[model samples]
Target: MASIARPALLRQVCNAAPTRRMASTFAGSSLKHPSPLTRRPMQSAFATPGASRVAAFHASGRRPILPPLPQVVDGDVNKPAPIPEPSASHGSYHWTFERLISAGLIPLTIAPFAAGSLNPLMDASLCALIIVHSHIGFQSNIIDYFPEKRIPLIRKGSFWLLRIGTVLLGISMYSFETNDVGITEAIKRIWHA
Candidate 1:
């Protein structure tokens, strides 16, 4: 009886003042006069009769429950395992992307130079650049969106990037092809000016 009363008293004291007074009171009471709540129950009729066992619960006061572990909550486990950081293979993958883009840009860059020389054949080079860039851009998307074997909604955006890049690149290329000779000579003359 005295043991159980101590917890209740400490609880009250703690509730009243959550300071050194409550901490000291709890420490003093728990060590010197252990509460009944802390004591193990003796074997009794409550132990054998399953229905009567519930009666014991009603008699004893409810104990304050401790907070749950930080990771789990509301029946759903919340912590997702961290994704592994990129590896050496990541460097290789980046290299692959660089190579692809570099290849596409090469023809595109040269087509402009040829156009500035007023070569009508430069239009074909421009077309080649735009087409190859579109094709390579689509391939890059394959690396991104097809890794898991299925097309994710994310891949949908790739189509747009490829289309826009192709159209804009082609238009830029075609314009330079037509105006190359006069534009180049004018820029040269301006530099002399």
Candidate 2:
């Protein structure tokens, strides 16, 4: 009698609306929005900190991990090509400190000489200075992107310098040059030349 009642109870439970909905939507259906259980398992994928962390890495230009190539021979030393070390990577110079000082020094040293001679000749000199300084600063500044963990002051300061120093020099020089063409000179040039 107890065994007979078990089937009846099971049949009633199966016929229940809530149980049918649950089984149809969850137990059997392969196509559906992620359920809470599924989401719980993959929550990290949508997690605030996790998503932002991955995004920060992407913004910082970091590469995601992948497995190494399969080995063709044991201790062969030729299966996988060794990555070429960066040209400046193992060199003696501290890239960031060198970069920061150079970035500032190049412009600062130049702007004064340029300020002292704001003639048309200074125009060519200024252009040349911009090119040479830009090249040196750019090469050095890019090393800040490396993940080897150099000091922050070294990198960040140079980064700021790359952003602002060129513009500041331009502005200062413009004022100096404009002041050279004074009101009397301007009148004379307009009336005379």
Best by lDDT: 1
Candidate 1: pairs in clash: 3-35, 3-36, 4-36
- 1-193: candidate 2 lDDT, tens digit per residue: 4426556444333333242344343565433433323322333322424223444445464455843333345457556766767676445565564565456556545554455434445444544455446755674555645222444565666667765866776665566445555322343466756
> What lDDT tens digits, residue by residue, belong to model 1 across residues 98-153?
57666766765665466553344544554564466566667677666554324444
- Please tell me which predicted candidate would have the highest TM-score against the true structure: 1
CA RMSD per model (angstroms): 16.7, 14.8
lDDT per prediction? 0.53, 0.48
TM-score of 2: 0.25
lDDT of 1: 0.53
The TM-score values for the models, in the order shown, are 0.29, 0.25
